[model samples]
Target: MLSYATIGVTDLNKSEAFYTELLAPIGAKTLMKMDRIIFIGKSMKEPMLAICIPFNKEEQHCGNGNMIAIAPGSIEKCDELYNKAIELGATCDGAPGQRIPDLFYGAYFRDFDGNKIAFNHFG
Candidate 1:
């Protein structure tokens, strides 16, 4: 339904570092991008991280207010991914847990640039 998904950020390097470690075990990585943009998702040739060159003071925070949700396979995998994201330094926006009893298990995190990112496991 879409070509790709992008999350904005403030620091490319910090975001890159965080993403590299977080996405590694999941098979996601920095694909391609300009200095002001860092694409970290699945390939190093695509830009999934649309980070801000510098901290934008006028920018609002990252949240459902403006965020993307990625659903992996199982709740356990979701938990692992969420843990990896945090271990790499992404801020915890929402912790990994049952979002809806027996319905959805997911977790949320804020990237280095403060973009809201989430992982959901529905199966």
Candidate 2:
């Protein structure tokens, strides 16, 4: 139902670096770039996640109930990505673990721009 999602960032370069590392484990790469935006995806033809400066020219801010979730293949991968995120300056919102035993295993963190993101695996 969703074609793509975009997150607002104040610093493109900094947000780019943060996302590059964060999305690597999930196999998403920088698929394209423009003056103030970067698109990420597993392939050029797939749905993308974009990071951009607000088009209205206002300061960027995270939304109260917005989040982006990624499935990185396994619970272990979820943990790995979560660790890598913290190493790259992300703040932990939740550590990697099973939130619903045998059903959901995930980790949550806030990106450099304070956008909430999650890495998870489900059985």
lDDT scores in order:
0.71, 0.88
User: Which residue segments of model 1 deviate by more than 4 Å?
Assistant: 43-64
Please write out the lDDT profile of model 1 over residues 1-123, one tens digit for every residue: 444666555556777787777767667776766866666676545435444454455553555587777766678778888988887777898888887887888799877667888889874
Least accurate stretch of 10 residues (summed lDDT) in model 2?
Answer: 40-49
Candidate 1, poorest ten consecutive residues by summed lDDT: 46-55
Measured by lDDT, the strongest candidate is 2
How would you encode candidate 2's per-residue C-alpha lDDT over 14-121 as one tens digit per residue?
Answer: 988888877887788888999989998888666778999999999998989899988888888889899999999999998889999899998999987899999889
Q: After superposition, how far is residue 83 of candidate 1 from its true place, in Å?
A: 1.3
What clash count goes with each model?
12, 0
C-alpha lDDT (0 to 100) for residue 114 of candidate 2: 92
lDDT for model 1 comes to 0.71
What's model 2's overall lDDT? 0.88
